[model samples]
Target: MSAFEPRPPFYLGIDLGGTNIKSGVVEDSGRPLSSVSIETQADLGPVVGVENLAEAGRLAVQQSGLKWDQIAAVGLGSPGTMDLSRGMLLEPPNLPGWNQLPIRDLLAAKLDKPTILQNDANAAAFGEYWAGAGRNTRSLVLFTLGTGVGCGIISDERIIEGRHSHGGECGHIIIQMENGRRCACGAYGHLEAYASATALVKRAHELLAEQSTRSSLREIPAEELTSRAINEAADAGDGLARRLMRETSYYLAVGAVTLMHTIDPDIVLFGGGMIAAGSTFLEDIRQHIQKMAFPTVAKGCKIEYAELGGDAGFIGAAGCARAAFGR
Candidate 1:
């Protein structure tokens, strides 16, 4: 049996995105005790981004009704390749000019508490494993389908951080080889090129332009079209929109099946804004995986929705910090 305390008073988790910063204080069981958010102002550059994130963390802890010293630690989730040992973010594509910033040390100095940093996808995977859909499962995979696809893999209750902490970057994994579309990452046939929310929007626009289709989506201005708008259209039974979603689902299923064959996880969880389209999106992907995955692996694994919603990255960051601090 384990000998850890039943719970801690509070811990801090921060989600640093290109557009916004969110932070929360959580009980040991993973429930949010308090939360706060602010604009990332990433255009202001890395210095401001770091300062804003640290300020968000401080505000979250203050709002949680706990003293600074009472909080155990802080965990931060960021986009980019991270050097876990050095606590540096190495040339993140989303945050231009943010090269080798010592995020962990900076945040720790600000808060006067230990801090740990991890890639957002990896943190989300751990969040799911610790307190979300992957709970009670020994191995799991999670994919966040947003502007781009982000993947997280947890095995034997441990988040897999391959050599150099670049493991589980499943979005970059090729699904269609040469015939596939070009990805934002400068690669052809990568899964995100077709399966991501941005890809869905692009496909929807292409479909609209190619046909005289009477989608409600067309009523909206072309510049206003988005994956969420298409999903709303799908919900309203727009055929063109439905077709776009189905195509996206098909490509996503192919990626999921590929991950299954490579990782053989016990469960696969899908989440992100795109998934708010609900079961139609999930069911289509499930159907494809059922048809394509190896029978043995398909039979043993289950597909489910991520329960943590947008908070998965924050919770996972906290869990990563706990792990880092040996708490």
Candidate 2:
């Protein structure tokens, strides 16, 4: 090899969730060269989950057609409170029956590569900041409204892992004043209780159960109701559906305003399945902020949908690996 020849290195990124473990190899240019996903089956055991991550990493690197040496290191994104200094997952609500898992050491041992771990939402935000929507700004907040609301904050190009590495739990912020909906964390009035996809479905159910409901959603079984269905119905002008959308959008905008006031981010981005509703949902959020927030605050911040799509987590994990390994 000539000394002047261009050299390219890659890092492996893994996203471990309750349902699936997604992995991919990202190039220096921030593109996912190859990807693989497998059932997490976390119910088996923590040991098995870590092993699955290692296997998934190997497969991703293999699919990238890169040898072990070509990949500098690995980054794993997990949902939960984490102590990066200790390389431990303190407590992940999504992955039940797991506690204080020393996943970094176990996965590094299994993959035989240096590794680092971060909250999955932070990883996604990092990916977006590095290569997606927030690429031009040094500070931004990403809110993912999925089964639960997950948030990641980046300030001055660094992920904010507060005093306990749990700083970015934006969803847990209080939205309702008193006697609001119960949240997954067993708290009342948290934004997660109203702005998340799960919350969207809950709102739909509540609307459908009311007497003399005229929405088409009444025809769908309660168990089959979903945020997507609600969005579709709202687009078709269903009264109940529009109510759910308006309510959720109100909460989400409040959350966004809160984030702007506190974090002072340059932009606020919304991700997860809820963004699938497109312009209408986005416009509603913007409208809420315009109406509810201080004019200066609303003018200072920009809100938009995340651009990395579904690959954000894994791609962000790769960015974390690059930073951790200095590759």
Q: Top lDDT: which candidate number?
A: 2
lDDT of 1: 0.86
Q: Write the per-residue lDDT of candidate 1 for residues 144-175, one digit (tens) a residue.
A: 99988999999888888888988899988998
State the lDDT of candidate 2 residue by residue for 5-100, as single tens digits: 324778899999998999999887787888899989999989888888988998998888778788888889998867877889877777887788
Candidate 2: list runs displaced more than 4 Å.
1-7
lDDT of 2 at 234: 90
lDDT of 2 at 285: 95
Clashing residue pairs in candidate 2 (N, C-alpha, C atoms within 3 angstroms) = none
What TM value does model 2 have? Answer: 0.94
